[model samples]
Target chain A: MLEVRDLHAYYGKSHILQGVDLDVGEGEIVSLLGRNGVGRSTTLKAIIGEVPPEGSISFKGEEIAGRKSHVIARKGLGYVPENRDIFPTLTLRQNLILGQKSARAQGRWSIEDAFELFPNLRERADISAGVLSGGEQQMLTICRTMMGDPDLVMIDEPTEGLAPQIVERVGRLIEEIAARGVAILLVEQKLTIALHISARIYVMGHGRITFEGTPEDLRGNEQIRKEWLEV
Target chain B: MEVFVFSLFNGVLYGMLLFLLASGLTLIFSMMGVLNFAHASFFMLGAYFAYQISQPLGFWPALIAAPILVGVLGAAVERYALRPVHRFGHVAELLFTFGLAFVIEEVVQMIWGKVPVPYDVPPSLNVTAFAWQGLDYSVYRLFMLLISVGIFVALFFGLTRTRIGLIIRASLTHPHMVASLGHDVPKVFMWTFGVGCALAGVAGVIGGNVLGTEPGMAIQLGPIVFVVIVVGGLGSLGGALIASLLIGVLNNMAISYDFSLYPIFSLLGVEREAEGILADLVSLTTGAIAPLVPYLLLVLMLILRPRGLFGTRDV
Candidate 1:
């Protein structure tokens, strides 16, 4: 379980995450939806301790807001950045190896499971990650975090630039992740995938949460979608 | 032929020494993105430490102990001095290291005095390894060559084969991502700095006797190391090797030849009595300009190929 309360973050003097609050129950899929530059990414960044957080954030009943990124990570939190920051010079397998909290520990997932989930990664396991296409890189980044075997993983825009069929595959993978009982806090711009996958959805506007409800409740609210989500 | 053979061996020996220093410098730069001005100071420290340790325990123990001691000092410096300055941005970091070089030099002088210490090759290794023509190569020089080559092989494998090595390569490009993956990146940095310094220390232990263990030794060898990395291409281990050997062999050949530009000038139909700068240039012998070879190569590389020979990214 994760609980965020009154979170505030800043870049220079301009406040990005202004007094935000959200939650994700154990094994639940929660999507944070917003337009560009509305602090969706910053919210995830603050929760993970990459950006300096001003409020309390509790992961599985322990406060983790101001801790260092690696410490928070060892506490079983994983983050996949929006840019898919794969170590371009490293091999695909090396990228996965780095994701593991410890090399010896057995986790819920294995490199084999990652390969099974997507066979393409196995085909190019020895090659450097730089040569991977955008879709393959997205899969690698997600699977890289999965190798850490975190109780909860925060993914920012996993399908932002992906092709349509790859987007469908990513959707299936998200479902597979939740099926394994790992909580996901997904930051997304596309409402269709969010509506299809998320158990609960929180729509954000101007650095604050404007709406929070189940997928059915969001689908019926045309006014909320028009004002906050629709371009 | 004898001159050529002797110069070739001497050049390779010197090149290996340069590689020992350049490899560490390249690793630290690639990992931390800090152009450590005090790297040569670490080399200087290694020699000084080896000299002091050898005074009591002899060269063999000094060779082992000196690098470990310098490594601990390097780690401590990273933790206390460099880490604090890191938050203030790269210029601050650069100035800090730049100042660190002067401080290290002053400290060495205060303790060791301004003069070169009597750090001699061990008596056991003082005998000639072999003789070619009239030139005899000492066992100590061969020993230096062996140690340098051994370190290179070890370093190469250590980086490419080990898990920690894998982590280091990742951190070089994605420090934040590596941290979020649960690696203690700062600790990685501290150790990286330590290991890099330890390498310089190894060079110091072997090189002190050969190069002379003086306070000014760091300053004297500092610029050439920069030339090496820049010409090799910044942050490339393979590039560093090629650049070091290129500069080393070129310098040795220049020094051995003792030829002047006068013949070329005559062939170009220049007046024999060419005035001022032209006369000065014509009269300059290769041996006299040997010291300037690396710098000249560095300038040429920057002008023609700024990214370096094996660099993946631009310098």
Candidate 2:
């Protein structure tokens, strides 16, 4: 389980997250839903130690607020940044090998398991990452993230730029990952995909969590969606 | 003809020495994106260390020991100095290195005095290796060639065939991603920097005897090595080799050629002793070309092929 309690995060002097609190239980798929620039990504970044947060962060009961991002990663957290940020010049194989640095075979994900999930990656293993199509890049990014065999994976916009079909495939993949008993913190813009895959959803607006409920509660309540999530 | 052969041999020997210096520089530049101004100072330290150590131990041991000492010193600098300044940005890193170079030079002067250490060829390799086309090639020069070739081969294999090598290659293009993958990227940077400085040290050990281990050698040789890296392109090792050899051969041919030996003059019935207008032309060409060859090559390379002849990426 991961817990963020009254987090206050900033980018320079500009305060981004003001008293934000959220949680994801063991093996649960949680989605942070919001319109653009709501500090959803910043919340994920703060939890993973990419950005400094002036609040308590407890991951499985260990405080990790001001630790380095890499150190936090070694403690069984995997972060996929918003941009995919794959090494452009390196081959897919090299990028995948890098993910194995924190890999644990018994924890669920393996190199062979990833390749089975994303078959296109196996075919294009030797090719440069930049040349992959947007959808393929998304698959590779997800596969690369899984290579770390993280206890909790933070996926930031995995389906952002992909086509509708690719987005659906990624939604299914997220569901599959959750079914395998691995926790995921997904930051997603597409409400349909977010609502379809996540068990519990939190709507964020302007750096604060506006609403949190079960999937049925969120779907039935139109007021909170219009106030915070609607364009 | 004999002078041509001698100069040609000297050029190759000097070229290999330049390669050793430039390889370290280019690797550090590619990985860190900082032009280490103190690189030549490390080379100078290598010379001084070898000069001092060879007196107590033998020349062979001095060669082995000096580079290790320089590598340790380089690691210490990376840990204590470079890491602290790395957060400030690239320009600050460059300035730090420049200051480091100045400090290293002053330190060397304090420890070794402002005198050129007398570094001599080892007695075991002091004799002539061969006489070819009426010219003598010292065994020491041949020894330098052998060592340089061996190093190039080893470096090539190490960078291409090892796990750490793959990580370094990955680091060259994407340093942050390499760290994010859970590998200790700082340790990689430190080791690469240390190895780079150690290479400069090895080059200094062999070159000291040939070029003379003067206190001012680093200042004198630094620009030429920079010229080699620039002409060789920024990230390509192949470019370094071609540029080193090209500059070497050109420098040799420029100095050794006497234009009075031109067959056209003999055919035209121009007297060899008449001191014609061509004689002054030849004298000017000879006077201006030796020190300027590498610079001229650098300028031409920058203008025509900015990425260098074999570079895969832009400068």
Candidate 3:
């Protein structure tokens, strides 16, 4: 479980996140829905301590605000950065090893399990990550995080730039992860993707949360949806 | 043929020594992304500490103790000095190391005096170990070769075999990602910096006898070490090894064929006297163009291949 209470974050002088708040219960997939540059990514970054937020970020009831990004990651928080920043020079196997060995996460998805989840990864495990296609890279990034076996995983733009088929696969994968009893904070631009996988949704606009509800409750809520999601 | 064989033998030995210094620089620079100007200064301190301690504890103990002391000192510098400057940016970190070099050189002169300290090779290694092509190879030169090779082997093994080595290799390419995986990155960095300095200190112990122990040793060897790193590529140990051997062999070959190269200068109608500072300088730039050759190679490498021989990222 994770609780981000009235979190504020800035990039230099720009106050990118202003008094934002959200919560995700255990084994639940929560979606933070927002249009471009509305601070959805920043909120995820803040929770992971990459953005150095001011305010309370209690993950599994431990205060983690302003800690080093790596420190927060070690505290059972898995972050899939917006770009899926894979170590390009390393082999997929080596990258996965780094993930598995370093993070304080142990779970059902071992390296072998991860390889089974993404068969393409197993086939290309020995090759450099740089040479992989965009879809394969995304899969590796997601699987690499899963290899760490975190209790909660934050996926930033998992479907961004992905093909429709891969996007669908990622949606299914997210659902599978939630089913495995792990919480997820899905920051997504694609409403359909978020709606398909997430149990709860929050709409964000101008660095503030405007709506929070279940998929059906938010389905026809046109006013807040149009203001935040339509664009 | 006999003189050539001797030169070749000496060349390999000297090259291995250069490799020791360059390897440390390459590791620290490539991994940390900071060209530690104080690296050679640490080398200088190693010589001074050896000279001071050798007076009381004898040469063998000084050789063993000096590098360990330097490693501890290096760890201290990383924790207290480099870590703070790292927050400011790369340029500030560079300038900080540059200042550190100056302070170290000044400190050496203040403590050891302006003159070169008489740090002799141990009597145990004073005699000739072998006669190669009728040239007597001193036991000290053989010792230097053994120590250099030993360090290289140990370093290579330590990097490839140990868990810490694996972490360091991963961090070298993806420092942030490594930290994200939950290892204490700063601690790894501190240890790396310490190891790098320790290697430099070991080089100083051996190199002091080869080139004389002095306050001037740091400045004398500093720029060439830079050349070694630039030519070797930013962070690749393989590249560093190749570059070090290349520079070392080239320097020796240059000495033997100095007059042959001079004729080419005459063919261009460009005499050394016309070339301003090149005609008149004693600071490793003029009379023995051997030392300057590595830097020239480095500049050319930068122009043609900035990523270095095997670097994955920009230099």
Candidate 4:
């Protein structure tokens, strides 16, 4: 479970995330839906301690706001950034190995499990990650984060720039992650996938959550979709 | 034939030493993106530490201890001094290291005086290993060669085969992503700086006596090490090795052969009756201008291929 209250973040003098409140219960897949730049990504970053957060962020109980990124990560919070930040020079296998918190400890997910999920990674295990296609790299990033076996993962736009088929695969991967009892806070652009996968959806606008409801509640609300989510 | 063999051996010896220093410099450069100006200063410190330790303990123990000391110092510098200045950007980091180099040189002068210390090779390794065409090669030189080669092999395997090595290589490109993966990236950086300095220390331990342990030694070899990395390619270790050997052999061959450009020019049907700078240039022996070969290579490499021999990234 994760709890965030009045989270505020900034980029120099310009304010980015202002008084944003959200939550993700245990084993739940929650989607943060918003058009272009409503501070959805910054909300995830603030929670992960990448950009310094002003308000309280309690994950599974303890306060994690403004802690060092690595410390926050070790406390069972995993972050997959928007850019698909795979170690380009390193081999795919090496990238996964580097993701492990400790090489000695066996986590919920093993390298084999990841490879089984995406057989393409296993086939190109020895090749450098840079040569991987956009979709493969996206899969690698998610699998790499899963190697750490985090209790809660905040993925920022995993489907961005990916093909429709790959986007569907990524959507299934999120469901698979949740099936293993790992909580997910997804920052998604595609409405169909978000509406289908997320148990609870929070629509954001201007660094604040404007709507929170179930899929049916969101599908029924025409005004909230037009005002906040529509381009 | 004898001259060629001897020159080749000496060139390789020198090349290996250069690699020892350059490998560390390249590792630190690739990881931190700071072209540590104090790198050769760490090399200098290694020699001084070895000399100081060897005086009281012995050469063998000093060989182990000196590099460790220098490595610790390097880690501390990264944590306390460099890390704070890092936020201010690369210019601040460069200036800090540049000033640190001068400060280290002054400190060495103060402690050991303005003269070179008598850090001779250990007695066991002083004798000749073999003789070829009446030319005798010392065992110490061979020992230095072996040590450097061994370290290179170990370093190669360590980087490619180990888990921490994987983390380090990853950190070289994605420091923040690595941290978010539950890794202590700052600690990785500290250890990387320490290991790099320790490598320079190892070079100093072996190379000190041969090159002479003195205050000006760092200044003497600093530029050449930079040349090695730049010529090899900025972040590529394989490039550093190739560039080191190339420069090393080129310099040694130039020194060994006193041949002038007159013969080549005459062969090309150009007369050597020029005046002023042209006359001097035509008459100059390769041996006389041996020192400028690496710089010339650097200039040429920059002009022709800025990315370097094996580098994927541009300098």
Candidate 5:
């Protein structure tokens, strides 16, 4: 479980995260939906300590605000950046190994499971990550983070530039992860995937949560979708 | 033919020494993106430490002790000095390292009195190792070559096969990504800097006697090693090795051959323009511009292939 309350973050005095408050219960799939630059990604980054956070970010029962990104990561929080920051020079196997908390941590996932989940990665295990296609890279980033066996994973736009087919695969993967009892705090743009998979949806506007309810509650609310989400 | 053969052999030896210095530099530059101007200063410290410590404990122990001392000092400098400047960006880090080099030189002068110390080869290695074309090569130079080769082999294995090596190699390309994977990246960086400095220190310990351990030692060797790394490529260790040997052999050959371009011009039946700059350019000898060879190669390499021989990215 993760809880964020009144989290304010800044990039050189330009206030990005004004006061974001959200939560993801254990084994729950929660989606935060917003248009670009409404601080959706920033919220994830602030939670991961990629940017400094004000107020409190509690993981399970312990506070983890303002810790280093690596510290936050070892404390069982996984972040998949929007850029798909795979080590372009390393092989896929090397990248996955680095995702493990220690050199020999057998945690919960294996490289074989990753290959089974997405066979393309196993085929290109020896090649450098730079040559991976956009979709393969997305799969690698998600699987690599999962290798760390985080209790909760925060994914920032896992399907932004992926093909529709690959996007569908990603949606299925998110469900599979949730089914395995791993909570997901997904920052997504596709309203369809969010509506399908998210137990609850929070619509954000201008660095603050504007709506928090069940997916059915959000689907019925046309006014919130028009004002805050749809272009 | 013998002159050519001897020069070629000497060049190989010199090149191996350059490789010892350049390999560490290229790795440091690759991983930290810091062009450490003080690297050769650590080399200088190694020489000085060897000279001082050898006086009490002898050359054998000094060979082992000096590098460790330099490594510890390098680790401290990285943690205390370089880490602070890192936040100010690469240029600030560069200036800090540059200034640090100056401080080190002054410190060396203050302690050693600006004089070349008497750092000599041990009595055991003083004899000739073997005869080359009836000319005996000192065992000391041969030992230096052996030490360099050993370091090269050890380094190659350590980087390719070890887990820490994976972290180091990964950190070079994607530092933040490595950190997010749960590594203390600053600690990795500090160890890298320390190890890189230790390599340079090893070079100095063995090279001090032959090269002379003076305050100006870094100045004499620094530019040439830079030429080695740049010509090889910014981040490619393999390229560094090739470039080092190429420069070393070419420098040796150039110094041996007193060649002027004026004869070629006359052979081609080209009329020399009297009192023109063309006459000045043609008469230049290979020996005269031998020191400029590496720079010429650098410029040519940059113009033709900016990424270098094995480089994946631009410097």
Candidate 6:
């Protein structure tokens, strides 16, 4: 549903993303894997119009490169930043309400559905989001993006700082979201989960995709992982 | 006792008016994180608009129309003037607003002249509302009190009980998150500035006659409102109310009481009307300098409660 070709982005004078090319089809889970500071996050940001992409970004056949972030969001492109940007001062309920395109617009996800998926959110729906645990905040950031009901979601590091159990839950949640016909572009640090879940994996190094293959193909090629991914 | 009561009532009336002005300042500052140095200029615009509108349509219509006109002007300024300078960082934006205030004052003087415009209270509400303690309070004062109270109530309800208000409150904290949710955030900021200036405009409509509408009107009221915001806390509406009322009452009391430090000296048998720096310091007590009270509160709040009474961020 999304097509990106020869994407390049910059931070001031420094080139952060250099000629990156990738795509994700309908309901397909694609993983972008790399070591820290390899432009994986910048690739997603460039696609989502945060970094001002230099090349081409066609999302469902629309030229969206250099568009404003909100305009991209309106075009059914949801972005969850790596930092887990939650409104700390706002209550969890208000945050969710803010996530929707319109309060009255009917979508597949409801507030009740979110509450059911994570009972912790339901219990503290009325309190400030700042007080939530890191894992709960991660859940909130993911679920909050789902409230927008984007056709394609670019999530950056969803499992960062999360416990193993919570990380498993995040993996399941991604699977559930993909099953519901939503395409996901996941930027993950952990290799095992990305390999297990992603239909296709793109190993990034030095601002470009060094390797792109199926999970089995990636497993067979240890040279690519040792050079681009392993610490 | 009667003097004390006089200051008390007048303080309340003035305090409410200050709240009317400061609440808008609070909203704009808290949401946009821009100080909006031009806020009081909007208040001045409201008064001038009321003066111009009331000339043809009369006082009541001007009261309603002036604020709306000023609000639109505020929105346009946000879109054109303020938004353009945002790229240069907050200091440039602040300087832009500061320069805008100067331009507004100069334009106001050119249009209305350097002299104060004859923006008087309506003839119908000129009569006395009530008399107590040998004082006859004008009905206009009561109207001002009632109108300010109404604004406070409406603003409170609108912000707390509506979806738009919820969005505004959320925007105050997480602007990017709201935008990611598909809101045109710049539009939200423009409207926020508009709403804030509208509230100030409304304050100017009622406060014009009492405070006087002149070129220096903004200069006089602007710093006080900033003081109100700072002392209240940078982002807390509740804190603004408390600070406004507190500043208002202290200002009046300070003006009314000629309670010099001479009393302590006299108690110590140091004598009256003595010469030198010690006597000069003692002679100059809380009298006729109401402006000092806000600055005092500001300093104390800065030193004691830097985050303000309810502010989460230290500004």
lDDT of 6 by residue, B1-315 (tens): 988888888888888888877888888888877888899999999999999999999999999999999999999998998888888888998898899899999999999999999999999998998888888889998899899889888888887767677778878877776776778888888987898899899989998977899999999989999988888888778888888888888999988986676777788777676778667766777874466888988988899988888788887
TM-score (chain B) for candidate 6 is 0.95
Model 6 chain B worst lDDT window (10 residues) = B281-290
Please, what are the lDDT tens digits per residue for candidate 6 over residues A138-187? Answer: 88988988998999999999999889999999898888888889999999
Candidate 1's docking class is high
TM-score of each: 0.98, 0.89, 0.92, 0.97, 0.94, 0.96
The segments of candidate 5 whose C-alpha lies over 4 angstroms from its true place after superposition are: B263-284
Interface DockQ per candidate:
0.86, 0.40, 0.44, 0.87, 0.66, 0.64
What shift in Å separates residue B151 of candidate 5 from its native position after superposition? 2.0
Kindly report which residue stretches of model 2 are placed more than 4 angstroms away from their true locations once superposed.
Answer: A102-107, B1-12, B258-283, B305-315
**lDDT per residue as tens, model 3, A1-231:** 799899999999999999998999988999999899889999988887667899999988899998887778777888887787787766788778777754455677888877887888899898888899888888788888877778899998988998999888888788888889989999998988888778899999889998999998888798878778885
Which digits, one per residue and each the tens of the lDDT, describe model 1 over residues A136-220?
9999999999999999999999999889999999999989999999999999998899999999999999889999999999999
- Positional deviation of A31 in candidate 1, in angstroms? 0.4
The TM-score of predicted model 2 comes to: 0.89
- List candidate 3 stretches off by more than 4 Å: A101-106, B269-287
Question: How are the candidates ranked when ordered by DockQ, highest leading?
Answer: 4, 1, 5, 6, 3, 2
List, residue by residue over B144-217, the lDDT tens digit for candidate 5. 88999899888888876677888888888877767777778889889988888888899889989888999999
- TM-score for chain A, prediction 1: 0.99
Q: List the residue pairs that clash in candidate 3.
A: none
Q: Looking at the true structure's interface, with contacts defined as alpha carbon pairs within 8 Å between chains A and B, what fraction does model 4 recover?
A: 0.85
lDDT: worst 10-residue window of model 3 chain B = B278-287
Please tell me which model should have the higher lDDT, number 4 or number 6: 4
lDDT of 2 by residue, A1-231 (tens): 899999999998999999899998899889999988889989988887767888999898899899877677777777887787776766888777677764344446776777788888888888988899888877777777777777788999999878899998888888878878889999988888888878899999888999999878888999998888778
Residue B288 in candidate 3, Cα distance off native in Å: 3.9
* Model 4 bad stretches (over 4 Å): B263-271
Ranking by TM-score: 1, 4, 6, 5, 3, 2
Clashes of 1: 0
Candidate 1, after superposition: displacement of residue B144 in Å? 1.1
Docking category for candidate 3? acceptable
